[model samples]
Target chain A: MNLYGVRAIYKFEMARMRRTIMQSVLAPVITTSLYFVVFGSAIGSRMGAIENISYGAYIIPGLVMLSLLMQSISNASFGIYMPKFSGTIYEVLSAPVSYAEIVLGYVGAAATKSVILGVIILITARFFVDYHVLHPFWMLSFLVLTAVTFSLFGFIIGIWADGFEKLQIVPMMVVTPLVFLGGTFYSIDMLPQVWQTISLFNPVVYLISGFRWAFYGVSDVHVGISVGMTVVFLAACMATVWWIFKTGYRLRS
Target chain B: MQPDISVKHLNKVYGGGFQALKDVNLEIYPGEIFALLGPNGAGKTTLISIICGIVNKTDGEIRAAGHNIVTDYRSAREAIGLVPQELHTDAFERVWDAVSFSRGLFGKPPKPSHIEKVLKDLSLWDKRNNRIMSLSGGMKRRVMIAKALSHEPRILFLDEPTAGVDVELRRDMWEMVRKLRENGTTIILTTHYIEEAEEMADRIGVIREGEIILVEEKNQLMSKLGKKELRLQLQNPLDKVPGELTLEPVELSEDGYELIYTFDAQEQQAGVARLLRTLGELDIEYRDLQTRESSLEEIFVGLVHE
Candidate 1:
């Protein structure tokens, strides 16, 4: 099983995180704090509740989702990419470890980091506004599932990217826009019928809706549909990762 | 006794249709230092990479420490440690952590005492807490060795171990190689530095253009191809060889001030005495004479050129 090898990779990544605490942990925490200050306190104080939930509390799950997605992708991608960049990947490839262990180590650590960040942000929301976990178990489950799924997706991005700019392109250009347009701030219900129908096409919509449902018990989409959508995306990422390792794409010659 | 490492019918063809190795067959016994010598693009690195399980081979069989490299990769890989030709390191990592990490990567349980001993042996104990990026090039090379040794593999492949290092570092590395061999570790090193092979290898294998042309005991290869040259400085110039010598006129150098005779080093005594007697019989007086032995470098050059 090469469990020691897996633990080595996991510890190495966690050490890297600790070494760059400011960039890894504090930066997102501070950035999300600003969102709390501006959107949750200042703007939401004037805005009315959208569906029996205060506007301040309504945005908590959405904001947590935004940070979770970005952080997970970056952590996992950068984790795998650094070895290739520094030419130390040969050590990992030559070790007595399986591809599954490799993925588990990198993705597991990345997911753990994002989940921790998600929890910290949720705690920070307590100071900004009041919110409750209508289903705490479901909330934690969604947090972990989303983190693991996105981290796997990020691992693929790391393998596919040839340059540093490519690493940033997808996360910034594709993900941020989808999260914004997928109703991170406002409900899609406020949009026209055609716009709401189009919103369903954005995968982030289901993720946010299911996560929001775990918090407020009210969601733009049914919780089961959102869960099903997230599971499908997770499986797709898993298949892609499996294929990448099987073919030795960008990893071996 | 069984071989410590063996490769049979190894062939590697890259995706672009470039064949890097062809029908390579080799066996390295336990507790021996075998040097693979070749020029650039001769598949030295590729051969080592495949045997270490880093690069996949198109066709072949390889066994390390009694385990097949592909079918039972985990144990095979665990039996070997590779110090690549290039100095690749995790720059931000501390020496202590990086060495321990390598040990763990081989599925070994944490053995701080072993890690400490490896670091101390490599003279890296004092720098254990320092980041790798802060070290000098030689120290980085040392750290690479430390990492490779941290796992205590039965076989070690040092690809160009002393390349691009200073004279002192090269000497230290040579000494270390001897010490490791004395410890009963089978070491396979690939290098173009003929002197390194001449100085370190118990057996030498020469690879040229993706093919292993020769492998022999160091002394045997030297004796088989070794040549000695004798040169004489004549007191007077000769337009030709005087046409009176028993040997051909090819022995005379241009301008005719000196004569050179190349012979087998092992039987040089008899040949040189007879040649000098003939020269005296011809009344060819010489002011000075010198003998030179061909180095391994010349033999290597000749083999590669052929």
Candidate 2:
């Protein structure tokens, strides 16, 4: 099954993360911490609690989701794209490993990185806001599922993109905007009735909602529906990645 | 004995409909150094890439070590390694780590001893910890070969292994190629240097415009197509040929100071003896006679031009 190949790619990617620790691990953690400083401490002091929870604590799930979705996509996209860019992809393609093993190695490492960062942000949140997970297992599950799903999606994007600018277009243009509008700092309920209805279409909303339910048992959308939506999205991403490899789209010629 | 690598009726037409390789059939014997010689855009790299599984073939079959390249790719690919033409490598990776990564990627268990041996063999042991970018061009080329060898494959494809390197490094690389062949690794290399092929290859294949026009043993090809020329320095100048040379035709120099006779390589002794007898009968006196044999470069150029 070329398990050694999978481990090679996984360990190679993990090594790259360690090499770029300042950008990969530290930068995201610092960004999340600043969100705490500005949005949690300074801003939450003026805003009243919504849904009987402190404003500082309520945003924890949303912030974690923000970093998770962003970091997962970026880490994974860059991880695969760099090989295509540097022409090292030839080695992987020509190796004895199958496409499945390649994906397992790359996406696994990226997802693992995102999960670690997500947890670090949670721990860092303790210094500023006293947050508690209403369901720890569910929280961890959601974190992992979201990271894996997004990493797969990022893998597709990495294969699709031919230019460095194309790599940034989806993450910056589509993902960041969705996360911001997905109720990262405020619930969709706080918006007008029409805006709240429109927010349901944003896929990130379901992820954040499911994650928020795991945190405080309060969410804009039902937990079951949120989980269902995430699973559907995950399936869609898996299919896309499978198709990319099967057709050798942008990979083999 | 069975072939280590067999390619039959292989064809490749890229996305834009430009055919890179025609219906090519080749069989590389186990433990032999086979060199593919071709001009630029002659499908040398494309052919290598297809066999290595980097480029998909449009049609035909390829097998490595009795395993089909596509249907039974794991076994097929596990038996082969490729060093591409370009110097493409992970610049940020240390030499040892990068080579080890290749071994693992090919599904082999980690072997530090094997990695160490490859490093020392390439004379890169001292630079194992240094980043690839820090190495000289020759060392980087060695690193590429090291990576290809990391998996200990039975078949190795070296595409232009000595391109852009200095003469001394080229010699070293050729020596390494010979050493690998001695270890029973079947090697198929694409190269522009015909002399290198003449020096090392057991057989040579000439590709032109996506087609392999000729493939034969190096010595056989030379003997069959080789042209031999003999020149005579006249003791005195003459205006034109005396026309008494009936067995063969001879060309007179413009100044009438020398005579040139071209003959088949296989009839070297007979052809030369007949020419000299005719010259003596014609009373053409010469001070010195010299023979020159056509090199592989000339033969290659002639084939490509034709």
Candidate 3:
């Protein structure tokens, strides 16, 4: 793998981002701000606190996940989809860029957007309410890990999608629903034992819980379990991406 | 001269049992333009796609500059560049960026000078900074060609490069192709425009029904398979062919003003002399006579249908 090839893909990917900064960067910020207002202030004012931390601060992790998930899925999926829709994939397909390079370029770009959006939401949340970070390392680690993991997952979604409708189905129907039901608004412990057990199966619950733990040093889920869940999901997503590249699935055939 | 491409018994069948190509064998020599002539769905694209490694071949072997296209795609692909028929480009990207990125895809380092030369050659120097979407259709097509040539490939494949292009651009592209050939690039072109192949191709291959029907030097193929027609204008019109005239190789014109006779020029016994003698014996007077030679398009259509 030549660095130049990777650089070319990275540059192209960013170029795509620049083309729709309003949607990529600005839209997420606005959406996250709304989340902070609606969920953070409107609901948190009456809900009070969770685990000694204010509800306003408690929901920060879930908010970040919301933005990260959307950004990762949209950025990566559209990044690949636009090329295909415009018939420009042949440019990449015919080029000497290997499958690995293509995946790295796209996923890397998606992660870049996810991180930027995450940081923006984190910073924006401060205006609404000041939150104390219990461990800076854990917070940063979770942010980076979540961004990379979801970006890889998004890359797979992009490959699997054949059209714009297909692209929207996974994120809108599957990912969005999972994130919402995974306890982004409230902890699963508040549910019945059966529902709580079912909620535990949702991969995103651990991501949000792990992130919540980082923000206020407390969560309904154990930190170790959350971290372990994220690692497992990340590994599974990476493996899926690797398999897609190795088999030349939609990229070639 | 050594052949730049050698394809033997190539075959490709898509997942739905669609056989795009079948037993395609061809040898494109270095520094010559070979035109693959065919109608739509005639396997022109499949043949070139297989050679370029964009589509997998179900069976057969293809070597580009002696490198197997499947086993050794990198070097072989590096040796060739393809100008796809579609006008696809990064709409938001600058022309210069697109060209340079294509070059980098081949693992080549950033070379501003090389980029500058490619842009200048395609008359895109002024539009280097402009977004690709802003360019006209002709300009975008040129950019596609520029990108293909950015790597300085030894063999260039133009799949219907002139389709939908205006006359001026078509002429300009032909001139550019000629210059590239002069620079020693082996060019393979597939086109429906017989005039383009007639004017540009050193050798021509007619393909149809997923098979290569004939491959021969342009002039040789034309002469070998060409037919000539003679139309004799009659002083008096007849609605039906005379019994005596029907015995020879002749048909009366629908307008009843002329007799049409077809003959192969390459054949030793064409019966043209005997037909003319018979016409004279019948005292069939004609005002004038005209002869038409088969053009490449006619020969191509004939061979493909045959």
Best by DockQ: 2
- Residue-level lDDT tens digits of model 2 in B1-306: 999989999999999999999999999999999999999999999998988889999999999999999999999999998999988899999999999999999999999999999999889999999999999988999999999999999999999999998999889888988999999999999888888999999999999999999999999999888989999999999887776764576888999999888887866478788778877887778999999989999999999999
List, residue by residue over B89-115, the lDDT tens digit for candidate 3.
888898999999888776788888988
TM-score of chain A of each: 0.99, 0.98, 0.95
- lDDT for each residue of candidate 2 in A1-253, tens digit (9 for 90 to 100): 8999999999999999999999998999999999998889999978999898889999999999989998899999999999999899999999999888999999999999999999999999999998889999999999999999999989988999999999999999999999999988888999999999999999999999999999999999999998899899999998998898888899999
Ranking by lDDT: 2, 1, 3
Q: TM-score winner among the candidates?
A: 2
C-alpha lDDT values of all predictions: 0.92, 0.93, 0.86
Q: Predictions ranked by DockQ, top down?
A: 2, 1, 3
Q: Candidate 3, what DockQ?
A: 0.54
TM-score of 1: 0.97
lDDT measured at residue A228 in model 3 versus the true structure, 0 to 100? 90
TM-score, B chain alone, candidates in order: 0.96, 0.98, 0.92
Q: Which ten residues in a row have the lowest lDDT in candidate 3 chain A?
A: A244-253
What class would a CAPRI assessor give candidate 1's docking?
high
Best by lDDT: 2
The candidate, 2 or 3, that scores higher on DockQ is 2
Query: How would you encode candidate 3's per-residue C-alpha lDDT over A1-253 as one tens digit per residue?
Result: 6567778888888877887889888888888888889878888888967777778877888878988987888888888888878887876776666677887888888898788888888899998867888888998899888888888888888889888898888888888998898778887877999999888788888888888888787776899998998898889998898887666677664
